[model samples]
Target: MTLTCIAVDDEPLALGLVSAFIEKTPFLKLVGRYSSAVEALQGLLTQTVDVIFLDIQMPDLTGLELARVLERSNRGAHTTRIIFTTAFDQFALDGFRVDALDYLLKPFNYEEFLRAASKARQYFELVHRPEPAPFVISPAPPQPVEAADDYLFLKAEYQLVRVAHQDILYIEGLKDYVKVYRQSDPAKPLLSLTSLKVLEEKLPPKRFMRVHRSFIVALDQIDAVTRNSVQIGATTIPVSDQYKDAFGQFISRWL
Candidate 1:
C-alpha cells in the first residue's frame, strides 16, 4: 500500500519542505529530490516510482515537458502519476492536460498535500487490484427471507460480474452466448456464455418475457411497445409473431 514518490523543485527550500512532508506521511516513501526536471529525468531512468511531485516551472526543463516524455516511455506498464506543485494558478489547467493526479497551489499546507497524496493512493489501489475469481457456494435448507435478492453474479471475461436484476433492460441471444444490456450503462453490454433459454427460466417471469427467439425484454424497461416491436432506450427490439399473442394479452391487462 506504500507509494514511492519523488519531489522536483528548483528552489532549495521548496524541495526540502516537500521531502519533509513525504517523510511525515506514513504511506508515502520519498526516493529522491531534484532541483530541476532534467536532474530528475536521470534518476527516473534508474528507478521506478508510483508518484511524482513535480514543480511546474523549473530551469533547464519544464515539468509539462518531462511529464509528456514519461507518458510516452511508460505506455502500458510501470506508469508514473504526476502531481504538479506550483505557486501560479495559470498552470492548473495545463497540469490537468498532462493528466496530473492533483495540483497543489503554492503555499499549500501539509493538510492539502495529504489530500492530494490520498487521491493518488486510491487511484493506484483501484487500478492495480486483481480481478476476483468466481466461486460457488453450497446450497442450504431454505428459510424465510424478508425480501427477495436484487442481484445475481455471472462469470464474464474471466471475472464475476454482479448484475442488479432491476437494472437489466434486455438480454440478446448470440448463438450460445447472451448479451445483457442494463439501464445504468447503455453503451456497454455484458457478454457471457449462457443460453437464452436457460436465462429465461432463471429470470422472474413477471419482470421479463421472451419476445423473440433471440431476445428477452424486461417488462419495466420497455419505454414503448408497438404491434411488432418494443423500444428500450435507443434499441428497438423486435417482438416476433410467435410471442405477439401473449405480449398482446399482457398489454391488454395493462391498458
Candidate 2:
C-alpha cells in the first residue's frame, strides 16, 4: 500500500532531497510538496496525508510552529504523522512535547531514512494491535516496566544521564521527534531524546505538566510568565494556542 505523504521545506535543495528520497521508496506516495509552511497548511486543510516531512526553520512559519497551529485548530480530520527533518540537534528534547514520530537530521543517508521508515511501519502495526498487558523490561521475567514511574535516564552523548521528575523544564515536539530540557546550565545544558510522548508517559504527573505543545515545564520551576512565554529559569518557552487553555488552567488551579 502506498503511504500518502507531504514534504515541506524552505530551501530548494532540501526540497529536491526529499523528492529524491521519496523516489527511492516504492511504498511512499508523494501526495504534495510545498516550499513554505503556509502552502502546506493550505494543502492539509483539504487533503489527507499519512505522513509529513517537516523542516523546523522557515521564513514566515516554521515546521514546529505550523504543527502547533494545526493541532490547536483540532479539525475533524485524519491525524498526520509528523517527521521532523532538521539540522538543529539541540532541540531534540523540545521536539518530544508534540509526540513526534521521529527526528531525522539533515543530509541523512538512505539507510537512516530506511531505519526511520521501518520504525514508522512497526509503530502502525503496534497501533493496530490491541494493547499489551503492561510490559516490563527488568532483570526478572515478564514484568511491567516499573522504571517508567520512577524516572527516565536520558543519554547525552557521553554517558547515561539520570533526570528526576522535578528537574524537567519542558518538552518540545518537532515534526517526527521530541526534545527534553531539564534543570542545568544556561548557555550550555543537558538534553537528549527524539520523542516527546515517549518521555511524557514516563514522567510523574504530580510534578510534571504539559504546559504547551512544544513545552512541558515543571509547574514549580516556572519563575515568570509573559503574554506568550513561560520562564523556567533562564529558558523562555513558547505556549502555543493548542496548549494555551489547558496550560492556563493547570497554572490557575495551582496558583
Candidate 3:
C-alpha cells in the first residue's frame, strides 16, 4: 500500500530535496509540502496523511512542538507517523520521544532517505495487514503445571519463541504489535502481534512497569532513572506524566 506523506521545512532547498525524495520513493505519495510548522499543522487538519517528513527547527513553531500537537490530537488508533529531517543530531532523543518512525540527518543521500522511508513503509504494512481467520477448537487438552514462570512464549512472525522475563530490557508498542527488546539480542527486537495491554496483563507487575502509553520497562533492567526518563543500556525511555507517580514510587523502593 502506498503511504500518503507531507514535507515540512523552512529551508527552500531542504524542502525541495525532501519532496523530491518522497516523490522518487516507490511507496510514498507526497500529499502536501509546507515551508513552516504552522502551515503544515493547518494542512494536516484536512489531509489524511500516513507519514510526514518534518524538519525540527522553524521560526514560528518547531517540529517537536508540532509533533506534540499531533500526538494529542490523535490519541487513539493509528496516528500518522513522523520521520524527522533535521541538521542537528542532538534532537534524536526528542524525535523518539514523540514516537517518530525514523530520523534523517540533513545532507543525507537518497540511500539514507530510502532506508528511513522503508521503515515507515513496514510500519504501515503491519498496521494495515489483514486479520487472521479464527481457529476452531478441538477437545480440550490437559493443562501442564509445575513449570517455572520465568519465561513466556510469544508469537513472533510465524513462530512461537520462548522469552525470558529477566532478559527483556523494555517493550515498545506499535500500532498492533509490540517490539520486545532483550538483553540477549540488543540489535534486533522480537516483534509480536499483540497489544501492549495484553502483555501488561501477562507480565508480572513486580518485574515490569508501564512508563508511558507506548512503553513498558523491565524494572530490574533499568540502569538509571532521571526526572522524566529511564536509562536501560544504550536506550533512553521517556516516562510520561500519567505514569510518573507510579514510576517514582518504584524508584523510591530502591533509593
Write out the backbone clash pairs for model 3.
Answer: none
lDDT of 2 by residue, 122-224 (tens): 5555446576585546776775544555566664532235667666666777755456665664344455544666666777777776766656767778888
Q: How much lDDT does candidate 2 score?
A: 0.72
lDDT of candidate 3 vs native?
A: 0.88
Maximum-TM-score candidate: 3
TM-score of each model, paired residue for residue: 0.56, 0.51, 0.61
Where in model 1 is the C-alpha error above 4 Å? 135-255
Cα RMSD of all models vs. native, in order, equals 10.8, 12.0, 10.4
Q: Each candidate's lDDT (Cα)? A: 0.86, 0.72, 0.88
Question: Taking the candidates one at a time, how many backbone clashes does each contain?
Answer: 0, 26, 0
lDDT of 3 by residue, 68-166 (tens): 999889546757888999999999768766777778888899999998888778767766879876556668985654446788777663334689998
| lDDT per residue (tens digit) for residues 103-183 in model 1 | 899899999999989988877886689987654554976665434456666645423467888999999999867899988
The Cα error of candidate 3 at residue 216, in Å, is 12
TM-score of 2: 0.51
